[model samples]
Target: WADGAVGPEVAAAYSARRVRLLDALAGRGVAAYGRSGMNVWVPVPDETGAVARLLQHGWAVAPGARFRLDSPPAVRITVSPLTEADIEPLADAVAAAVRPSPARSYR
Candidate 1:
């Protein structure tokens, strides 16, 4: 919020959408790290692959490699500024793109 704070209704909508996205991702077996309120970091087997897959489904996520070479393969999913109705679809796309392999903690 560059201009102080948002109106009550806008704030409520953002909060509700964030919750919806978090719930949907959790339901599909996605474990997210970092701040759950904003940019969520989810480590995967291949960040590049996941981003490509998500892009095909209409959602675009940034790979960790884009910012750092030391970080493990991860995707940054934005929860805020998202639509309530699109939450489930994005979650489904994530599930399809990132599958938990053996020896992984994502379950």
Candidate 2:
């Protein structure tokens, strides 16, 4: 962008990927707060637990607490390095990590 190295097509691709991640997460009933840029913020009940769970799925996300904000617990996920194929799996992992599971009943 600075040296005209980043063209419109490249920037468009980045924007597209970000939107894909946001849409995927929304489809899974996960709320994400990001309209532009490469990072999406997802609010979770427990930031630490969410981070740990996502890590277990091979995805590293930044805990909102790291930002020192007084807002609710959330995680920051960067979508820049993720490919188009990675969106669904990432969204699934995020949804699983952030949303509480229903109690299982053994019959």
Candidate 3:
């Protein structure tokens, strides 16, 4: 392994951080898959908007459409390499992402 040692404690800390983020997203109507490990694949109602919102808050995620055709709007959030401090901001951004914006009236 090129990346140094990863013990149980390190792994557990990351898992806890991921779970917090996942729970935060769940409150926003976003669902995360990957029952095991640190795989964070969230199926958002608006992949484009979700990604944009996350990006606006200094977070990055993989768009589902980039990997598959006929796929729903989704984004991938990898929590392994990220720091635990990221959970709050990421959660806040994710929660804000699901909010409906003002309606636009077409003339």
Query: Could you give the C-alpha RMSD of every candidate to the true structure, in order shown?
Result: 5.8, 3.3, 3.6
Best by lDDT: 2
Q: Which stretches of candidate 1 lie over 4 Å from their true place?
A: 1-12, 34-37, 67-70, 100-107
User: Local error of candidate 3 at 63, Å?
Assistant: 0.6
Top candidate by TM-score: 2
Clashing pairs in 3: none
RMSD value for candidate 2: 3.3
Candidate 1 lDDT over residue span 14-89, tens digit each:
5676667767888988976643245667788998789888899888899887756687788988677577678888
- Give the alpha carbon lDDT tens digit for every residue of 13-98 in model 2: 77888889999999999999877667899999999999999999999999998865579889999887899889999999999999
TM-score each candidate.
0.72, 0.83, 0.71
Evaluate residue 58 in candidate 2 and report its C-alpha lDDT on the 0 to 100 scale: 98
* Cα lDDT of model 3 by residue, 1-107, tens digit: 12557777777766776787788777766667655456577777788898898888888888878766786777877788777677777877876775667699999
lDDT comparing candidate 2 with the true structure: 0.89
